[model samples]
Target: GAGVSQSPSNKVTEKGKDVELRCDPISGHTALYWYRQSLGQGLEFLIYFQGNSAPDKSGLPSDRFSAERTGGSVSTLTIQRTQQEDSAVYLCASRTSGSGGYTFGSGTRLTVV
Candidate 1:
């Protein structure tokens, strides 16, 4: 793909259910990031993967949230025991190493009801 791609553009899940969001970055991007945007809130960094280095999980909100990048191209973000507060637009972005610009996906809108 020429740009970042995300799956399940919109997801409606019952409270306590689990959900997974997928992201496929550009062919050669080396840096991938996950962010969350709540209504009326700014983007919150969730996780970051750079090349083969250990992922930076410091931004994950809780133990229920986890993510991994496979083969350094595709990534998945899983949310367990979903809650209403978890409803948000999950965004994925990618950029080449040392690049200041990023290409972002349309995002997966998760609504927990």
Candidate 2:
């Protein structure tokens, strides 16, 4: 794809259910990032994956959130035991190792009810 691609533009899950969001970054991009944005809040970093090194999961909100990048191209963010507070727009971005800017996906709008 010419740009980052995220699946299921919108998702509605029950309070206790789990959901998986997918992201496919541009070819050759070495860095991928996941972020969350609450209604009027700024973007909150979630996780980052660069090349083959260990992923930086420091920004994840809780133990229930996890992500992985397979083959350094496709990534998945999984949220367990979804709660109403989890409702937000989850975004994915990718860039080359030395790029100063990132290309972002449209994002997955998760609504926990």
- The weakest ten consecutive residues by lDDT in model 1 span 95-104
- lDDT tens readout by residue for model 2, 13-112: 9999999999999999999999999999999999999999999999999999999999989999999999999999999999999859999999999999
The TM-score values for the models, in the order shown, are: 0.98, 0.98
lDDT of 1 by residue, 76-110 (tens): 99999999999999999999999599899999999
State each model's CA lDDT, in order. 0.97, 0.97
Q: What TM value does model 2 have?
A: 0.98
Model 1 TM-score is: 0.98
